[model samples]
Target: MTQPAFVAPGVVTAFCPKPTSHTGVVVMVAAKGDGVVVLDSGMAEPMPDALGPALELLGATTADVRAVLSTHGHRDHTGGSRALRDASGALTYFSADDEGLAGFAPDVPVTDGDVISSGDLRFEVVTTPGHTAGSVCFYEPTLKLLVAGDGVQGVGSARKLPVYYESGTRYRASLRKLLALEIDTLVVGHPLAWRGANTHVFTGAQCHELLEDSFAAAEAIRAAVAAVGPHPTPHRAALAVLATSPIFDHFDPGDPVEEDTEATLDSELRDLAGTAVR
Candidate 1:
């Protein structure tokens, strides 16, 4: 576990459990008055107490956690929610669209613009459906901080390609939506890289730059899939798409991009067949 880094007047963050692992979560804590909120709990089993460091830094305990917010339903992000909630008796907020994917029912189903308040910290939910149908980002406009989880993946450190199991178009759109926000500090679930730099945190202009690169990387994959036609297997298609993009030049080819390639191609093929039938 890494030490909790002070993000703002009331916010602090730490990459819980294995900081370098893509499967680990970035735990963020915000407090004001007597209430504290935790965002993105790590996996439950291996490191159920992943938020300990951040909580300690805040000089609080599980009892102070009034709400636990999940950026998405993925286990890495939500698996630890049960443990935390059990300890803190906190309300868990998740998106309704992702109820099917989550292991446990949420205390509250959040919408696109729901404002969650804890003392002076007010986090506005920004529903970004692409990484997953229910993926959401928390934006603290007053602090210009955005806890994005996996919502803005810019070619993550573990893989050469960005992965969005849902619609690539929607993923790109979500990135664009995030770009419109006034973000100075951006924290993500993984140590995603752009060009040659890898980090889970982005500040000031780096936030915009990271979002742009992520958007462009997704577009490059979309275009590459279209150009490669539909004859190749998903794996082969991924390789072809990779060969055409210089953004992946330094990284090793991995399975993550293949998943996205398959999803993107399948969507396009379905569209084409629909057009033909029409």
Candidate 2:
């Protein structure tokens, strides 16, 4: 069980099953007295009880959970939705593009700018398709919170898969789309974005602050795609992109975690150190 921490006016975010300083997967709950909302259910069989613990942290559960909003179709974020929905009887929602992938269809098909309000809480869906064809982030204007499910990945290591992203152009557009929102608490699906220490989530000013790095990562990838061209060699093209990457710590998620992200960066620098000498 991940420790739940208060993030914004009506939000608490936690990394479940196990806790890691920089892992991107997380569960978030946003609530107000009359109703509650589970942003994303963790990867579990029965789907963890989102309300009891969420309200407990707030010193408040009535049978008033209004909905479960999934940011994308990825199993880690949406796996527990059906179970939670079955248990709480709350309405479940996700992007329509993900219906084929997530298995269980949502009660409400969410689209860009679609608003979901429960009592005093309101979340507006922003379509961000790079992470997945149907990936999205929810913005609570009142709470100034953004539930970014893998939308803005931490740069150190990323999961390379088609479901995660297909078009760099669409991905960059998605990042710019999110930059327009007003946010104080940003709950990323994973904490791929770096901090001094491995930090899974960003709260208050740090949310907006860390986005600078996230945006730069997007731009860097865009550049890589351009450099790769129409007929690029897979391995050489990838290494070339990594070489010119602005985000220094990019790696594959399946890559060994024992290797500290910084150490990989340092090794790259050491390899490049002799260039000036030569």
* Winning model by lDDT: 1
What's each prediction's clash count? 0, 6
| Best candidate according to TM-score | 1
TM-score of each: 0.88, 0.77
- Residues 1-278, model 2: lDDT tens digits: 35777877667775544234345346555566356788887775535553456667766552556688899887778877787777668888999888887887889999998998877777889999866688889988877888888787655434331113444456567878877777777877764536544555677777766666666665554455445544434334534565545454445534332433323223323333444368
Off by over 4 Å in 2: 18-25, 50-52, 60-63, 158-164, 228-233, 240-246, 250-278
Candidate 1 TM-score to native? 0.88
The stretch of ten residues in a row with the least summed lDDT in candidate 1 is 19-28
Candidate 1 positional error at 89, Å: 1.2
Q: Model 1 misses residue 94 by how many Å?
A: 1.0
lDDT assessment of candidate 2: 0.65
